[model samples]
Target: METDKRNLGGRPGITVQDVQRACEALRKQGRTIGPTNIRLELGRGSYSTIIRALRNLGLSASSKHKGGE
Candidate 1:
């Protein structure tokens, strides 16, 4: 199997400590803990990266249900 080129190269990955710091800061400020908010607080991470970090922190994406079966 071939790997996706997009995932081949980019800036260095963000550390768990970095994510934790941003999360703690947001919590201290009474902010919601979400990927977008965390990214904003970090000021330098991709959406996917932030989401992965959130997952590592035990946060999962909210699920959406279809209506009108």
Candidate 2:
């Protein structure tokens, strides 16, 4: 029951730590941790790619990934 139109996982070639670091940098700049910001921060990757990575990392627009800070 699988289809090429549906992907079961996040797109490859991007790292969680890289997203995390980008999120951290965004936080420092008082920006939101959304796909567009992340993509701009990354200077590569599509929005979907960034979003999947964020979802995989349990991060969202209002994520507190850097908790206890």
In order, the Cα lDDT scores of the candidates are 0.62, 0.67
Instruction: For each candidate, give its TM-score against the true structure.
Output: 0.66, 0.65
Model 2: per-residue Cα lDDT over 4-68, one tens digit each: 22343455555666677798898898776788888789887666666766776676645543544
> Which pairs in model 2 have colliding backbones?
none
Q: Candidate 1: deviation at residue 10, Å?
A: 5.4
Give the Cα error of residue 31 in candidate 1, in Å.
0.5
lDDT of 2: 0.67
Model 2: worst 10 consecutive residues (lDDT sum): 1-10
| Candidate 1 per-residue lDDT over residues 20-69, each given as its tens digit | 68777777777777777777898877777766666666766331222331
Worst 10 residues of 1 by lDDT: 1-10
Off by over 4 Å in 2: 1-12, 61-69
Error of 2 at 31 (Å): 0.7
